[model samples]
Structure formats: C-alpha cells, structure tokens
Target: MPKVTFVQMDGAEHAVKVAAGTTVLEAAKANDLPMVGTCGGSMVCATCHVKICAADRARLPPPTEDEEDTLDLAFGVTADSRLGCQIELTDALEGIRIQLTSTM
Candidate 1:
C-alpha cells in the first residue's frame, strides 16, 4: 500500500493508505471525502481536482489533454492542479500530498 495525504481548504490534513495502482479519486471516495467525483474517473469532469504538492509534482505524470480540458471548468486551478482520477497510487509516491481544490 501507498500512503498519501490530502489537505482540506482550512488546512486540515487526512492520511489515507490505499492499495498500489488505486487512483487518487478512488482513494478519496473510499475515505468518504467531500468530493463530488461525479465522473468516476471517466476523464470527462473536473469534480475530483486537487493540487499536488510542489515537491511531489515530479512523482506524477503530466495531465492528459482531456484532463486539462476538464480542469478548465474547475475553480481555483493552478499550475500544480491535476485531476485526481489521473493519479495512480504507487510505492514511489508514498507521502505524496495533494490539496483539494475549492468547488466554490
């Protein structure tokens, strides 16, 4: 399993350990985070958007064009922003931190 941290808007943090290869969106949903995850990793929506920690950015691959397009509909997107559905958990990514983006 790989452990990841999710930061809330108010700076609260939650740690989740998930099996390797599980997507961030899946982990979040499993943990009952307040995410919409409306598209269920279909790559058609940005409801699962999150901001990767600057130091952990290298552990993730660049987002696909489809992800970028969906993110255009997200709120408060930044250069570090990525769709959680596209990020797979792995041992190499242990301790990766990501903050949930505001849905406002």
Candidate 2:
C-alpha cells in the first residue's frame, strides 16, 4: 500500500493508505476526502483536479492528452495540476501529497 495525503483548502491533511492499483480520486472517495470527481474518473470533467506537491510530482506518470485538455478548463490550475483520476498509486508514490483544487 501507498500512503497519500490530501491537503484541504483550510490546510487540513487527510492521509490514507491505498492499494497500488488505486487512482488518487478513488482513494480520496474511499477515504471520504473532499475531492469531486464529477465525471466519475472518465477524464471528461476536471472536477477532480488536484495539485501534486513538488516533491511528488516527479513520481507520477505524465498526464495524457485528454487529461491535459480537460485540465485546461479546471479552476486554479497550476504547473503541477493533474486530474486525480489520472494518477494511479504505486509503491514509488508512497507519501504522495496533493492539494484539492476546489471544494466544489
């Protein structure tokens, strides 16, 4: 299992241990973290947008073209922006940290 931390807007940290095959969005949902995956991990809606911590960003796979296109429409987008559904957990990503892009 890999541990992930979701940083809330108010600076609260919610950490969970998830299976290697689980996506960030799925882990968040399973743990009752505050991330909205409006498109159900289809990469269609950018509602699951999150910002990978600088230390963890390099550990993730590069975003797909579809994810990149969709993320362009997300609020509070940044260089580290990524759709949570697009990030699969891995042992290499242990202690990964991400910030929810929006509460909604």
Candidate 3:
C-alpha cells in the first residue's frame, strides 16, 4: 500500500493508505479529505488540483497533456502542480505528500 498525505489550506493534513492503482483524488475522497473532484476524475476539471511536495514530486509519473491543460486553470499553480484525479498511486509514491490550495 502507498500512503498519500494531503495538507489542506488551513494546514490540516490527512493521510490515507491505498492500493498502488488508486489515484490521489480517490485516496483523498476515500478518507473524506477536503479535495473536490467536480468532474468525477474525468480530467476535465481542475477542482482536484494539488501541489506535490518537492521531496516526493519526482516519484510521480509525468502528467498527460490533458492534465497539464486542466492544471493551467488551477489556483496557485506551481512547477509541481498536478491534477489529483490524474495521479495514480505507485510503489515509489509510498509516502507521497501534497499541499491542497485554497481553490479546491
């Protein structure tokens, strides 16, 4: 299992352990974290945007063009910005940490 940590706008954090194929958004939703998935993981909405912690950012897979396009509409976009719904959990991301922006 991989553990994904989500730090909300208020600094509160939630950690959820999930299977390798789970998406970050799915992990967040399963744990009742504050992430919003307006498109239900369709990659059409930026509501599930999150900033990947620098330490674990490199472990993630490169984002697809569609994900990159959606991230452009996200608030507080950073070099590590990613659409949670498009990020699948993997063994290398066992302790992945991400920061949730105020917009989502």
TM-score of each: 0.94, 0.94, 0.90
State the lDDT of candidate 1 residue by residue for 3-104, as single tens digits.
899898889899989999999899988998867788888978789999997789987888888889999999888999999999999999999997987766
- Estimate the overall C-alpha local distance difference test score of candidate 3: 0.84
Q: Model 3 compared with the native: what TM-score? A: 0.90
Name model 3 segments beyond 4 Å from true.
Answer: none
* Candidate 1: residue 2 lDDT (0-100): 91
Write the residue-wise lDDT of candidate 3 on 1-104 in tens digits.
Answer: 98778888888878778999998888888888888888999988799998986778777778888899888888888898999898899878887888887663
- Pairs clashing within candidate 1: none
lDDT of each: 0.88, 0.88, 0.84
Q: Give stretches of model 2 more than 4 Å off.
A: none
Note the residue pairs that clash in candidate 2: none
Query: After superposing candidate 1, which stretches have Cα over 4 Å from the reference?
Result: none
**Candidate 2 local lDDT, residue 97:** 90
